[model samples]
Target: MKKAVLASALSWALLAGCSQPAQTDQTIHQVNSVTNSSSVSDQTTLTAAQYSEQFIAELWQLYPEYALYVGYYDYDDQLPIANPQRRAQELAWLQQQQATISQLLETDLTDHQRTDLSLMANFVKRGIWQIESFKSWQWDPSEYNVAGGFAQIVNGNYKPEIERLRTILKRLEHVPAYYQAAQANVSKPAIPQTRLAIQQNQGVASVLGDELLAKAIASDMTEAEKIQFEQRLSDAQLAVATYIDFLTELLPEVEGADPVYRLGDTVYEQKFAFDIQSQLTAKQLYERALADQKMIHGKMAELTTELWSTYFADQAMPAEPMAAIGQMLERLSQVHAKPAEFKAAVEQQIPELIAFIKANDLMTLDDDKPLVIRHTPEYMRGYAVASIQAPGPYDAKANTYYNVMPLDGMPAEQAESFLREYNQYLMQVLNIHEAIPGHYTQLVYANKSPSLIKSIIRNGAMIEGWAVFAERMMLEAGYGDFEPELWLMYYKWNLRVVTNTILDYSIQVLGMEQEQAMDLMVNQAFQQQAEAAGKWRRATLSQVQLTSYYAGFSDILVLRDKAKQAWGEDYSIKRFNETFLSYGNAPVPVIAELMLK
Candidate 1:
């Protein structure tokens, strides 16, 4: 389930932008041209490099936040134009890029160069579509927007930048305008009999009122800044109030008596495909998930028997497998670290991982951007257990922060249990995923890539896929002192995969209630009751996010095999990794097309 969630989260984000662009001939041409050009490119000459670099620079300006997140900060203080007029202008810019890239494709370029061009062009077309058609601004109700706003303000431990703070203020000022626009544009076609409009409304308000508004006003700004911020706050409040009023007025206009807005099967299918990026029908995906779930269950059963016979030969078997697992977890938890301890662990492991990479002659690390690991703050805890906060676009120094949440406020017994769950082996798993040969390593190369478009459409599947792949790689390379516990950790990671697949299908397809999903999580995945409940809530809030890990890992494995088959004896692990990372994190199909060519 954990694996599935990780996979789904990554894929969900990618697919979110899939159906955004209204299909127009021009748009289709733009998308096709880029994809076709890349399908043929083969050369790596100076001219190709120049063209790629130039195109990336132009592309970066289209999505400022993405640019900033990727360490490009030329227009740090500026926000993407959200108004209809501005969107039209941005769309025009995309059209120009597409035309230019298409022209470039007509040049006498090598297959590799053409491939790179197609990749970049596809990126431009996608970006244009998302910006112009998706109306992400209209769907301001997404948790991502709220979470992004929170991350900017108080990632809790880190200080918010003045520019970021200013952007937040601006966004707040425009909230009322945003909501009004959404109200005007939003169409409520069908209402679900079991819709939780009230809960969603409350959730939206809490995020806006308590998290966004309160946090913004509480910031210690300069006198002038404060006044400006307050004005924006007033405007946002007014907008939200108006939105509530609009909702009330439209309540009677709804076609159905149910609180839930029924998106209908067609719309739901569109959303599902857009997010998953696969041609697989919903029924197909659901069946695949069920089959995968059963297979994982069998693997767990086999492992249980093997571990019990090998490791616990002297002791009597526990009544439940979870009891034995719990004992092992307890032993592992003894290796807990406070902030200082956590830092020390990082200090010890990072250099070793670096040395291993260098010794193994893996891809070269960028001396310019060093990776750093740190503890997560309280505020950001709710969103992620840990993450790699990518560097801003303008910032040359790229640091990947490995956030280890502190166990400061818990009761002694609870703290012990938590620590047991996060022992050394678990930490190593995280380190490999977030740091060396994982996100940090992959992203460093991605940051330096020539294609700006790939960076913008950065798929989470690729990101998590690489991390999960890296774990397996390390194991194959004899990591974790060749201990069974390390292998156990790998299996535990699959817990996410299993849980994600089951819950996604159960909730979205099988129509399993949240309570039932929670029960499955606790029983099958060994998640604590509270954690299981939270997982159920998250599943409802985020559909298909859990499937990304398994799906991504599966795709990556296929990619690896294809690369090996194509290169044969010429293939080197390091070279393949570098080549893969060079494209940045693109969709698997796109990446496969580029690599195979």
Candidate 2:
């Protein structure tokens, strides 16, 4: 998952969702009535269903942006000010929720209720850790942007144009105060994050610009109302500009300060637990990745030897395994779509994947939900090349976007290197991971999940791991007609996952530097220079996220093996997949416990 603005804890979507909850009559009443632990404690006597509903209501009040993200629109016009007072409030709410969930877990309950309660407890503990221990708000200025929340409202079809515009106008009123609070909260900020804040904020006006203005003007609202909306838009844009200026000016002041981006071993351990939620500890996961790396290299070498003559019949192969595999991949990568045809190629593969899933009876495919392919939004660029923007469970009717970054303006060499990295076979793997039977498919099932807790408190490891698992699963089920080239690229892509764990753990906890990191990616993992450069940048920008792929993928594959043994004659790929995903996006371990039971 791509991080969004204000994701101080875990991924961006995880925390940004908390920043934008809406306010309806029910929410306002809940917020006002539930002022202390006593009020929430009273709800514990209620049934699991009742208590969960009440818990979500209080949660929305605390993290309103999250409410907006999950399709609750009551507080769309409100933006939580990231000031000291608000953090204290969040701390108190989390402690109370933690207490209530602890008590609930002790009660007699069904499997589903227990699973949901456990997830809620995990979510609450993470929030508490964020406030008390991993306090990113104090040093990460990039966590303060407001453009994404507004962009969601502008692009969302949840409300009509005029209504959404009105929400935007009301929310825009707080832009100045929001940044004021942000500026006040930041202290000794990380220089790298400060620079990123400047770049991300520079595009804030896109969401508040002509497209929104045109909608407001065309709406049936009064002329005076339209004028008022335009004025607010201008102010919001200026607030964004002012915030960018603040970050730009603050850069030099902190350039020579301590390098605080590295979350040392102590904090890294705790963060990995909360974010990945895996059965293994950080050290164990790192060790497993190291072993997987050697094994994948061996597999890639075998494929390279088999295909060497097919691509280079007249040439002699390198004596070293890494060199031989690298040369073979370089030849295979030459066959790729042009930069202009990148997005079109991705778009064209969606239906093919859907058909394969149906023909093979892999899993049930939902046709009602539409997947819209588009360019990555301006404010969300500078991170990953592609991501999925799925509507929250509450707004299931809204379109799910497959966000591909356009290569239109990239330098020609950079674009070619990128295209070669994606290549033809790997591009199909990318589609499988990002679109059909991956994020888009998995997320659609999440929204349909009956348990609200499972759908909303999504685990990044499971989310990412499922995508990685889907890639391997598709190929094994006869995707690309069992081509060795596709398998070679698949192994190469899988190596990326293994090295991602190694790169992240080594850098954040073990003090790995740029040169060593590049050697691992380009020379060892066989990634192109362009792809390696992006991963290096991304590794610095995030922590524990890159590791999610291997952590989750390995855990999931192990779980499936146990299921096969336990289910015996009843085990089938479709049966295993549907049952696994049925738990929504709960952590892999949690899902495993429930599944194996």
Candidate 3:
């Protein structure tokens, strides 16, 4: 699951009835009784699928933020409350439902039916862990930020201005209770998380006071409506401000306390199983990443030697292959975008890349989908260089923002290095991953899937893997001249993903400090100083997430090769991607079973 969306699933209504932690064997038999007894269209199978679908949809109502993300506006006005009591209730209900779903007679369910049930099971397992096991409610302050409650309102125009604002105001009324509960429940706030929450709350206040209400919500309101809107927003600002103050006040108490951010091996591995649903364990994934890292480095070395001969045919070759590769890449760095032109270059290249995809039939081009490029929200920044804040699977018309953070405020040397790393060729690769045929394209198809279960229970590895795969696919499909320079840059980008897996496992599990971590990223992966530094923070703030790109990308590549061997002449990139992604964002292994079998 994407961290933001799942953590955002905080709602009192969502957990209202989860206190019922009991499931009977007969209830389990509904799934058990269905399997080979009927075809997919048979009454029994459809009955089971529909039953599970309804259960999944109803659960969506509990998370309004998630609803908005997915484009379901039914709960737009509601905000989720996070406290010990509600979490306990939600956890219990999840356990009961999970027991019933997990025990469904495997013989009775169709392949698709089993996949949906597995998706549900994954969600329940993660929910149980997040609540009872991880207990982030007690320490992760970012969990309590209501800014997202406001963001959902302003970010989407699924409803008219007045209607959306009214709904937002209704949710805003609960802002105080939401944060108050945060204060109550997060009795031991982690300092790093607390600092982030404070920063995020201030961002919410600015958007609410300086932009949202003043500009959009009350932009053209009647005098009477304006007064009500202003009052509601004024109150929201106070509640958010109060929470920010609490986090700020908490800074002193945590000054000497340990950071306590790593999930440790035990919790992190359990999370990997639920989120990734892969054949490999964390250790296996990390070891594979190490091998893959060396392999990619070797390829880059060979390619750079070719480039070195092209430019310096008269000179003696460097004894070490890495030295030659490093020098060649350094020269390629000069070909990057100027700081001022970085984002625009990315924007300009997208349509060109999409045109290429369509012309080559590499993948289907759905021109109907809407996309935009903009600065990332303050609350969402500090995680990655670029990311897609796409509308959830349910909402198609809403614009999927390709968030590109500006490097202006960064130290001059850092800014230049960051941009150079996102060089002209690399920007196109990043665009391919974050937009076009990457997250945006896959997500658009995911939205159209018959099952919402796949969308809600997003497998991080699958989502990231597809994006990483997309980058390679586009380059192989003949993007940007298929030149040695471009391919070398592409290898660097892939290296970043491979090193990401090794680096994260190294830091969080092996407890490798910054010195060693930096060496792995900079020396081994050849990442920029600025990029490596950002990843260190991101890895600290998150665990098991960075590894998804390598794990998912490599797994899907293996799946594609098998499909190629099996389909023979029928194997086309377009066909494979469509059939594979058609199943939605369930774990790749689940998709593999359905597609490969």
Candidate 4:
């Protein structure tokens, strides 16, 4: 799966907002000052921009980990405890923020400020819905892990090593209480989430283990501070271990509820609304995907026929479109990186992609931001084979990691299947979608956005859509010198995007079984066995996320066409791209409304 971007902790990762200062006195005082003085009626006195800043600070107090991930360190030492008291606090805060935003939206404001305010309003509403209605915190144990947040601090370079270590030492104080609250809050846990929680927690050693201790020992901390740090780290490790044990024990007991990973139609639809924030509804997106799938299949068949003589001159072309296409794909799939060489292959393509973008003058490429291709973190594994971990909007200078899962230890047959799925041509498309002018590039632009509201309250459809759009844009610009083979493979890659919408909607809402889903992906979508299986696992583990690719891609394509006609002779791809991206990672429909105006 070409999943991109890990936004710190997953609980409120999508709801980007605020972070506290590193100093406790200042952080508390600033937050308290805002809360004590600010009210909905008072919000009308402040400009939207000023109110937004205040609201973000209050949100940071609620979700310190999210702030830390986004490069705000004020709440570095704090971790939220998932109990009724905290939930109630979150609900109250969101309600107040929602009312304040609604009042602000009624007053006069700049278009930019208005957009930001609207995004903040939506984010507040989503948070309220998540607590009062969606309530994943009550059922999803995987939502409770602290490892990713800690890893963000330890692995991050926003501060000096010693300073970060001190922050970590302070944060460790909350670990035991956080887990205890997690244990109390979860009820009727989904089996998949329980297993994922255990699996992810096993990675706590990566952060709190001897390596961190070694760093502290080598640092400039005083002896007393070092001892205190050591004790806290040990306790934090025990807390994580205990949480894992609790989950392991609870797994079999929850089987009686016939626990499911799939959220039904009603829940899935609402999540799509909040998570995607697209102009089209989930059902509308699914219908478009079905139509798109047929169109892509027709094109693939035409390409297959065109290429048959080149690869299979010795044999007759099959009368059936699918059979011909499948055979051609099998032939092309033979060209792939060896399991050991996969990461190296991706690394090598970075420069090639950069050259292509610049040569074509697709858009301005930032040379300052570094892209690092590395092994997928242990804590983040089992979901996607490759993903991008870009620095949050606050920390743009941090490395944007292109996390590629190593193929080591996979059974030979499985590894071969996997490689075939990500074959040579499709791999290039994946890079375009996940790196270069895809997620990494888009996120960098997102951070540069003047509006923090837009940056933090990011729309998944806009983010994923741009990456999907990047795939086709790069190809159309003649990246592969118009190779029919490359174009044929590109069609297959596009099929993955289209089918992702179909697969997600089908499984989550329509109850698609494994056999039917495999047939849809492997046979109809032309995915390899390994890729299809991994996607099926991903579909079950997630809701609404799979649909983002198609949702965003379709929205972007439509918007670009509109921009062409609206701008007329003024239109240029570079202008459209930069202008569209300038709005930060706001939803495509919002950007379209602005640009087409």
**Backbone clash count for every predicted candidate, in the order shown:** 51, 14, 8, 2
Model 4 spans > 4 angstroms off: 1-4, 7-11, 16-41, 253-259
Q: Please say which candidate is ahead in TM-score: 1 or 2.
A: 2
Writing each residue's lDDT as its tens digit, candidate 2 over 134-199 gives 777778777777877787788888878888878877787777777887777778888777777777
Error of 4 at 418 (Å): 0.7
Candidate lDDT (C-alpha), each: 0.55, 0.81, 0.71, 0.80
RMSD of each: 8.0, 2.8, 6.3, 3.2
| Superposition error at 18 for model 3 (Å) | 24
Off by over 4 Å in 2: 1-12, 15-33, 253-260
Displacement of residue 200 (Cα, Å) in model 3 is 2.3
lDDT by residue (tens digit), candidate 3, 137-244 = 677776666665467677677778777767766776766677677777777776666766676667675457667766644456667776777787788788888888
Task: Give the distance in Å from residue 382's predicted Cα in candidate 1 to where it truly belongs.
Answer: 2.8
lDDT of 1 by residue, 6-99 (tens): 1001112332221111111112233334434542222233366676775565444444444444445454333332345444545665666677
Superposed by TM-score, candidate 1 places the C-alpha of residue 84 at a distance from the truth, in angstroms, of 5.6
Best lDDT among the predictions, by candidate number: 2
Q: Please, what are the lDDT tens digits per residue for candidate 4 over residues 447-506?
A: 998788778777878888899899899888898998999999999999999999999999
